[model samples]
Target chain A: MKRKIEFATIVEAVKKCCIEGTKVLPQDVYLKLEEAEKNETNSLAKDFLRQCILNADIARNEAMPICQDTGFAVYFIEIGQDVEIIGGTLTEAINEGTRQGYKEGYLRKSIVTDPLFERKNTRDNTPAVIHYDLIAGDKLKITFAPKGGGSENMSGVKMLKPSDGRAGVVDFVVNTVVNASGNPCPPTIVGVGIGGTFEKCAFLAKKALLRKVGEKNPNPLYAELEEEILNKINQSQVGPQGLGGDTTALAVHIEYYPCHIASMPLAVNLNCHAARHYEVEL
Target chain B: METKIIKLTTPLTADKVQSLKAGDRVAISGVIYTGRDAAHKRLVTALDENRELPCNLQDAIIYFVGPCPAKPNTPIGSAGPTTSGRMDAYSPRLIRDCQLRGMIGKGNRSQAVVDAMTQYGCVYFAATGGAGALIAKSIKKAEIIAYEDLGAEAIYRLEVEDFPAVVAIDSSGKSLYK
Candidate 1:
C-alpha cells in the first residue's frame, strides 16, 4: 500500500512556504547584499545598498514583504512515486495555499489574467508556475522562489558553436549584463546554464540561481570558469544602479548538463538584489 | 548621509523644482498621495468623463506605487515605487488638468511626459524601487482616501516624514541620467 499524505497538511505547508519565502530574504542573497554594501564605491549606490539591507532586516522583523514586487510565486516539486496525495488534487491544494498566503501575508497580487489585452488582476495570486518530477524516494521536496519581473525580463539564452567554448560564454554573459545595466537592479546574481538544449539551458540557468552564494561548482573546470567569469563581471564597473564602481555582481553560478556533440547551448538568468527563495522537504 | 525633510505644495514653481537634482538625498514630508497603473487609468477615465477627482491634484506630488496590503496595527505594508514608465500615457493629462507639479517613481520616462513636465513646471523624483521596508519607515501614516475596492492599487492619502527620494528629472528639463 502507498503511503498517504494529508491534503490539509500539504496545503498548510505550501502557505507557510509562500509567506515565509516572501518575508525572509534567502541566506545566499543576504550574504551577497552584505558583500555588495561593503564593496560599493559610489556614494549614492552605497546608500542604496544600505537601504536594501535595512529593508531586508525590517521585512524579516515585521513579517512584511521585502519588496513591493512580491513576484510570481513559483515552485519546483519532486514527488515520490510510492506516496499518494489524499483528499484533493495537488494543483488545487497549491493554488488554495497561494491564495491564502497572498491574502494573509499582505503580499502584492502581481498576476494578471491576460498578457497582451484585457489585462486584469487575478486578485488572489493563484496559479503558480509549478514543475514536478517523479523521484525514487518517498519524500516530497518543494522549492519556492518569488521571481521579480525586472531581472526576469533581462534573462537570455543562446546556442553557440562548440568551437566558441568558454570565451563565447563569457562574452555573452558580460554583454547581457552591460546591456541590462541598472534595469535589473545591479549587484546581481548571475546564473549561467551550460551544455544543454535550448529549453534545458534556460531551466538550468534558473536552477543555478537557487545555489548558495560563494559556493563553487563541483566540477573543477567549471568551478575555475565561474571564478573567471566573476572577475570579468566585477570589472564591468556597472556597480549598483549602474553608477560606475567595483562589484557589479556578487557571484556567478554555473550549472551544466550533458548535451549532444553538435550543439553548445547557454543561458543567463539575472536575479536582483532582493532574491527571495526557500526550500522544504515533507 | 544626513537626512533632510522638505514639504511643498503642488503646482510648484520652477525655482523650487530646480533647486533639487538627482543624487541629492531628500526626505519628502507632509501630504502625498499614491497611484499606479490601475489608478492612472481611472484618473484618466474620470478626466474624460468630466467627473471630479478623488483628491485635489493641484500642487500635489503623485507617487507611482501600488503598495502591499496593510497588516493589523501597521500604518502601511511594503510601500515602494513602481516603474514610472507604465504611467507615462496618463501623467500628461493629470499635469494639465489637475495642476499637478511633481511625480515620484523610478526608471525612464517618455519624451512627451518630459516635455509636459517642462511645460507645466513639474518635476520627477525617484525613490529606490525595492527599498520598501526602509521607505515604509519614513511614512508616518497612511489612509485610503479613494478607490477602496482597488485593493493595493487604490489611492492612498499618506502623511509622511522625511520620505527619501532623488530628483530624476528637474524643472528645467535636465535629466539626471544624461
Candidate 2:
C-alpha cells in the first residue's frame, strides 16, 4: 500500500520553512562569515562583516528577515514514488503556504504578476517557482530558498566552445564576480554550473547555491575546482560590498552535468551573505 | 588608509556635497526621500513633462530602497538599500533636471551617472548591503509620501539618525568601485 500524506501537512511544513529560511542564516554560513571576519585585512571591511553577523543574530532572535528584500520564493521538492498527496495539488499547497507565511511573518512581497507588460505586484507573493523530482522514499521533502533580486539579477550564463577548456571556465567565473562587484552584496557565495543544455545549466547553478557554504563537492576534481575558483574570485579585490579587501567571496560551489561534446555551457549564480535556506520533511 | 567619519543631514547643499570624498564613512540623519525603480520612472517622467513632483528635489538626497512592511509598534521592518545600478538610467536626469545631490545605495554607477555626478556636484554613498535589521535601528520614522499603489515600492520620507554609509563616489569624480 502507498504511504498517504495529507496536503495540509505539506502546507504547514512549507509555511514554517519559509519563515525560518528568511529569519535564520544557516550555521555553516554564519561560521564562514566568522572565518572571513578573521582573515580580512582592511579595517573597514572587517567592521562591515561584523555588522553582517550582528544583523543575522538579531534576525534570528527577533524572528525577522535579515534583509528587506525577502526575495522570490523558490522551492525544490522531492516526492517518494510510494507517497500519495491527498485533497490538493502540490503546487496549490505550496503557493498557499507561501502566501500565509509571507503575509503573517511580515516578509516583503517582491514578486510581480507580469514580467514585460503589466508589472503589477502579486500582493500575496504567490505562484512560487517550484522544482520537483521523484525519489525512492516514503516521505516528502521540501527545500525553500528565498532568492533575492539584487543577487539573482547579477547571475549570467555563457556558451563557450569546448576548446575554451578549464582556463576559460575560471576566467568566466572570475569576471562574472568582478563585473557584479558590490551589486550582489559581496562577500558573496558563487555557484557555477558547467555542461548541460542552456536552461539546465542555469538551473544547476541555482541548485548549487542550496549547498551549505564551505561544503565541498563529493567529486574530488570538482572540489578542487571549487577551491581554485574561490581563491581567484577573492583575488579580484572586490572585497566586502566591493569596497576593496581580501575576502571578495566566501565560497564557490559548482555542479556539473554531461553535455554534447560540441558545446560547453556555463552559468554563474551569486547569493548574498544572507544565503537563507531551510528544509522540511512530511 | 583611514576611513573618515562624517555626519550629513538631508536637504543637502553643494558645499556639503563638495566636502564629501570617496572612502569616507558617513552617518546621515534628518529627512531623506526613498524611491526605487518604478517610482524613479514616474519621477523622471514628471520631470520630462515639466510637472511638479510631490516632494521638492532641490538639493535633495534620495535613497534607493524599498523596505518591508512595518510590524506592530515598529516604525518599519528590515529596511536597507537596493542595487544602485537599476536606477542608473534615471539618476543622471534627476541630477541634471532636478538638482539631485546625493544617492544612497550599493554597487557602482554607470559612466553617465558618474559624469552627471561630476558635472552636477553630487555624491554616492553605500550602506552595508545585507545589514537591514541593524540599519532599521537608525530609522526612527517612515511614512509613504506618494505612489502607495506600488506597495513596497512606494515613496516614503524617512527620519534617520546616524544612518551609516560609505562614500563610494565623490563630487570630484573619484570612485572606489574597483
Best by TM-score: 2
lDDT of 2 by residue, A38-68 (tens): 9999888898899899999988887779999
Instruction: Report the TM-score of chain B alone for all candidates.
Output: 0.91, 0.97
Candidate 1 CAPRI assessment class: medium
Relative to the real complex, the DockQ score for model 1 comes to 0.51
Error of 1 at A36 (Å): 2.0
Q: Which parts of model 2 have CA positions greater than 4 angstroms off?
A: B1-4
The prediction achieving the highest lDDT against the true structure is 2
What would the per-residue lDDT of candidate 1 be over residues A112-228, giving only the tens digit for each residue? Answer: 888889667889987798888899868888788888776788889999899998899999988887777655766788999998799999989998888887698999999999999
Residue pairs in collision within model 2:
none
Clashes of each: 3, 0
TM-score of each candidate structure, all chains considered together? 0.90, 0.98
